[model samples]
Target: MVANFETVTSGVNLNQYAGRLEQLGPALDGIGAYAERQVKLAIAQGRKLSGERLAPLSPNTVAEKRRSRKARGILRRDGGLLASIQFQRTRANEVQVGSNLKYAPWVILGTRPYKIRPKRKPTLRFYTADGWRSATEINHPGLPERNIFEGAEKAIGPFATATIAAHLEGDL
Candidate 1:
């Protein structure tokens, strides 16, 4: 025989919190997928707008630099605005890193010169077989923010449905 445990009731429905947490997973997954697609689209868009002649560094090197200098120049011109959207909390994909989000608005400009200090000791240096590289790295940091945004948006529609379901279940 199973022992019946007496339950205490609270003003807030306990099921709601559990339901929210359960719903969070799918929301996150949808967000992740959206973010991945957006990054790829952005990369493609950037490459198209660059108008750079992509020539082989050598006949053997087939891995083309997707972004051209002209594209980078254009990106740099508007990078400040992009950075602002990236860092803004109100923006769909804005993310906050260490320090504060305030720095984001101007950080993308690349206008600030990086200061080089003399090394205290001789640094070990070696030349790799590969030559120079492009500025476009595959890392997309906006993904998490995108996921959160999507999750939040998804939650609104489901919240009402879930609440109604809970009420009906309790009635039975």
Candidate 2:
């Protein structure tokens, strides 16, 4: 006598998988928003750290004294540059955090000695306690690299990983 066995297979509907895949866009949006917040916080912390690293303003001259009084700290005078730092998502997978300050790059990456030409060709004058003083053309010694932007970038990797993991697990 010969015994025969029949094999049975079950059909799987892949449409459910596709449906879950479709939810990925919205999930990524949520994660992007979360990452943006994390990055902004990192940048703020970096700004504080950068401020601490800067050289203190000297109160030698009257102008310097007045500036010291009005300014919060070294690079944070009037808080213009620091306040300009902002974050925005440019694409689904891209986020940019930066400042609109024209000198931001110069601050981040130290520059070499460069010539200075004022728009006023005849004479450059600056405010002083007594009156306007004639400014002389002098090669400016560049600032040292502060690494504030690097600090912010370094914080993003771990944050992105954790955030993505949490999002995948539905904990985000």
Candidate 3:
């Protein structure tokens, strides 16, 4: 008996998966388009609401005033409009949200196409000497009602703020 060994790397050759890859494009595109449309709508809604609220502050001012306005929460609190834009950008960059079966070809068949599923419960797990341990688990207080993207989008607004604050505070 002879034992043969060869180095095996983990990856799907896009060329090898071309057929499946082609099947995935339309679905990936659809998800992407849906996300893009939702993000655009979210930003537009934010802008419209903010614009309506700040309608009284019309009339362009000098650069200094503009800077002051930003500081004073005139244009958008902590660049909220820009924050909203960045929120979309963040989601766009998020592996869980932005990723699709196209890049993760195996997920399509092995999993359910990687669509974001609403999380009813989110638990943090840790390794212990005895076994796996779960820390305080907070069930999605808004679960069984909202889809994952909606939940993510809603949560991201505050999470992003907290994240920035944490970074600035050197907590992260």
Q: Write the per-residue lDDT of candidate 3 for residues 1-172, one digit (tens) a residue.
A: 0011111224735455444433433333333344444443433343221122222222332233454455433333343432332111222213123222142222111223222333554655543334455655423222111111333344333444344334334454
The root-mean-square deviation over C-alpha atoms between each candidate and the true structure, in angstroms, is 16.0, 14.5, 23.0
Report lDDT (CA) for all predictions: 0.29, 0.49, 0.33
At residue 18, give the lDDT of candidate 1: 60
Task: State the lDDT of candidate 1 residue by residue for 67-144, as single tens digits.
Answer: 222223222233442332221122222222111335432322223433333355343222223644333222222211
Question: Candidate 2's residue-wise lDDT over 1-172, tens digit each?
Answer: 0011111113745454444433445445554455445534534454422234444333333465474486534455566666666555454444555666788777666678776557757656555556556655645565666545444434455555555445445565
Structural similarity to truth (TM-score) of each candidate: 0.25, 0.58, 0.22
- Which of the predicted structures, 1 or 3, would earn the higher lDDT when compared with the native? 3
- Runs in model 2 lying further than 4 Å from the true structure: 1-68, 125-133
- Give the winner by TM-score: 2
- Count of residue pairs whose backbone atoms collide, per candidate: 0, 0, 0
Residue-pair clashes, model 2: 0
After superposition, the stretches of candidate 3 with alpha carbons farther than 4 Å from their true spots are 1-22, 47-67, 71-172
Identify the leading candidate in terms of lDDT: 2
In the predicted model 3, the residue pairs found to clash are none
TM-score: the better of candidates 1 and 3: 1
